[model samples]
Target: MASSKSVLHIITELGRGGAEHMLYKLLSAMDGNLANHHVLSLGSGGPYAEKIRALGIPVHELGMRMGRPNPMLLLRLRGLVRKLNPDLVHGWMYHGILAARLAAQGRPVVAGIRHSIYKLSSEKFATRLVIRAVASLSPSLAALTYNAHLSLDQHRNIGFSSKKACVIPNGFDPDRLRPDPKVGARLRAELGVQPDVFVVLHAARFHPMKDHKGLLQAIARIKDRNMVFLLAGTQVDSGNPALSGIQDDRVYLLGERDDIADLMTAADCLVNSSWSEAFPNVLGEAMACGLPAIATDVGESAAVLGGTGLVVPPRDPEALAKALVQMKDMPQEQRIDLGKRARQRVIETFSLSKVASDYLASIKMFWMPTAGDGPKDVQEKEFLVHVRNRGVYQLAGRSGWGRADFAHHDRCGAPSWPR
Candidate 1:
């Protein structure tokens, strides 16, 4: 067997967000026989660091100061790269991509674009310069969603060919998520919600892009008194202050709980009103837990849902309210069927195994054999000869054959094949 390859993955932080969660999933699902992995966080470690560390993968917290660029940070990163000497450097998100590309020099760098173009701009010229620099320096870049790939084209316009830029969707582990009736009951009871009350859940950080205000306005427009909205996610003070008022009897703002899977199960439906998204993981998680979703038709939402959920136009609370009402009146059997289809779609197309394989295949392609490395036919013959010499073919038939008596021995010695 060939020696295992080393890959270093760099990310902004180990935060509890979609990109961070996907990074953890990818690292955990990586084939140990193929590569040894290491992770570095350019920003401070958060909730995800512990879980990543628990996976026996080395996690480094670079203790980077937020909101300011330090030249020494790049030097430190380069030092890490020199010490680790990874065969490949995989960067996630913007800052991580910038730092990793600079540190990798001319080494193979895979930059992961996770968000939309609307989210890429910065008022600071330095940040934009860094982004452009990274885009120029990266030998190859990968987008987590098709929208992200489009976003890259619209914004940075990094002229890398299609072969150098590919789309690799996010994936989820169905087993890590399960529907817990007790969790739903406990959350409902804690919020003083009646047993019969219908809950619409929105689990996302209180960011301006998430459009929580629009969701709240839609819920306020609902005429039904029995309907409650469960808002669970981190609350950022930087976002619109008006969203803070959403905390009321009908709208419960549960800030950043670890039991999101349980909350998805507890809710009548999962709601997403994001102004933009590359590929929201909440929709996949909700579907995996057999919960129907209602989302704004933004950033591959419709594609991800695949008719398993309802979609409304962004920033339209009236339409959102109408959809909510429609979903509320939907037959229980039909809703369950939709949820099953959602889960099945995720299983078939977005499982962690599938995503990992796609990434591995892409990486292999990125490292294509150079001239004088031998042709495909020669490589195949060499591989077969190695297997045969190792006695792997003895089990192919009931009886083992002598080396000279093996079929196609002459073919192995042909000029087209490697010696």
Candidate 2:
């Protein structure tokens, strides 16, 4: 019998990124009757892992080697599935999707494609081979934006069928992301920024794809002395060369931070300089916190921002700088109104509850087991772990035995397990 309440989510890591954050929100808001969730991280867990665990969700860290796929990882994952016996296995990102599909040979699987295929290109044959494998194995795939879905359709290598592919925009938990005024004040004061300064905030991973150089150049062009730029993201290497020797009192690099909501609220506008994105979560989060954004017209950024903020051409520093200046000179009342509109847009379109409900509905409609395909009784022996720390003396000098053996001896009656 199908429980319709069990799902296992597999991801490459639990780092602070858009896709990982989306998964966190979805898992947090999952319907109690419709889904019980577990997570498996291919890499070591990070800050978000503790948050998930606090929700009483089981999170397993595989600590697998990065950059290269190991066949042993698949075997370990398959064993994990057998032990957990979840009704559905959902994969996020390319590597996780491929591993999930391979492990779920006889089970239902759903893969999330979080980026546009147009953005995915590699000169290496091995990378292409892995992409082809993922395309071939995923039974159902989802894209986070309309443009992402369209991009998938355009790629010959990613043979995601139209009927099996769906677009589900990333959603946010507004309560967890509420802005803190005091924190914002302290942050500005610590940075020596004046109360009247116009701050432009850019929050993204410091990867080449984010086009941080373009953003820095744009900041250099903005002649306004009262305007300051705050860049918050992970520094990939020693430091970004584009940001080198460009130290002015106006530019600040606040590397990987925990209080993003405060930074977003403190800023006059959020800037996105990415060359590509599937659905920029920072854009949505900043908007939700009542901040207008200036993003390059790439990926689904324009779609996410809607008409609430200005959109510029990617890689054109001059155009971005011009937009920044325009926003800086705009009336305070109009800016506030624009921020209000942005928040309203997020509330209307991208609530976490709505996203979880949609995912549940889709599962029920497509992957629900039929009469002949009903789930079988999972053996308890497959999930047993020995308790070595017994308070008293050991029994019969044996450490442990499988549940089947215990059942045969009537140690545990009938060995019934949850379906």
Candidate 3:
């Protein structure tokens, strides 16, 4: 067999986030023999830096602070890339995507977009600038990956190419996240929750995008004292001034905990009120823990639910409250069946092994030479054709390349790639 290729991963930061967690898990599940992997964090490495290093992977940091743009860091990154001379560069988020292209120095780069682009007006000034910059640079990327289809469509509408892009939803570890009735019962008892009380969980960091206020209002509308709401995530504690609007005594704020699976098992269902997301990992985790969910129709939440639970419009407190009531009104047997189906969907389509394999395959597709290269397998040739034909430019009402672009061929009989 040929020797493994060198691949460098670049991310904006190593902070606690769904994208950061997914990267850590993907690296852990990927086969080292396939490629030599190294990570470069553009900002201070957070909790994940040590975790990734513990896996025997080299983790480098630029020590750049968040919300501060530094051009010199790009020069340093280029110098580091020149020293490493990786065969491929994989970028994680918006900042990393732009940095990867600039630092790769013509090497193949695969861009990873983890956040949804619902509206440019809704993003911060710095983020909007970065998004437009990446959109202009999107065509040059060898390939791009999105965590949700909604992100892909939203980006494509704003001049990003969808030809060489694909959506690979976040994966879950079923073995560690599965349901346990006994554990759930004990947790409920410890939390002073009665068996008859209906528990609703909202698991996401306290961010404006998360729309915690909307969820709180929805919970407030529900007068059912037996229905309890558990809020768990970063800064989601009793002291948060943002949560002071809550007047419900049944609401429990669990700042942040390591065991989210246990929290899921203890709840009858999960609730997401975020106005923006690419793919919410908590929903998948809840489903894996055999709990139904009621998520806003943001990003891929509804698709992720797959009808196993409920979906409401984002920022609509009335709709969210109604969905909560609907979930509470369900028969015990029916809810159990929905939770079972939720777990089955996750196991069948979004297992860790499966998503990791998809990432590996997409990386290899861009890394390998194609068309005019030496003899190629049918699969490789087909992939190139697909990539070539799918390269689209929709900005300014420009339709993609014409059939004439693919009419000509090289010796391999495959259509020549668009210039």
How do the residues 143-211 of candidate 3 rate in per-residue lDDT, one tens digit apiece? 777876568778887888765665667888888889998988999999999999999999988999999
Model 1 worst lDDT window (10 residues): 392-401
lDDT of candidate 1 over 71-146, digit per residue (tens): 8988888998999988778888778887777788656666777777554463257666766666565434332222
Give the candidate number with the greatest TM-score: 3
TM-score of each: 0.82, 0.82, 0.88
Summarize candidate 2's per-residue lDDT along 1-419 as a digit string, tens digits: 32556888888888887778878877778755566789999998787787788878899988886677778877888999999987778888777787787777566676776766553463246656767777665434422112242344444345644333445667777776655667777888988887888889998888777998888888888778988888888873236565656667787878888878889868889999988776788988998888899998876677677689999999999999999999999999999899988887777767676666766665543344345433422211111211111111111112111112222211222121111
Error of 3 at 356 (Å): 1.1
Error of 2 at 67 (Å): 2.4
Report each candidate's C-alpha RMSD, comma-separated, in the order given: 10.7, 15.1, 6.5
lDDT for model 3, please. Answer: 0.82
Error of 1 at 224 (Å): 0.6
RMSD of 1: 10.7
TM-score of 1: 0.82
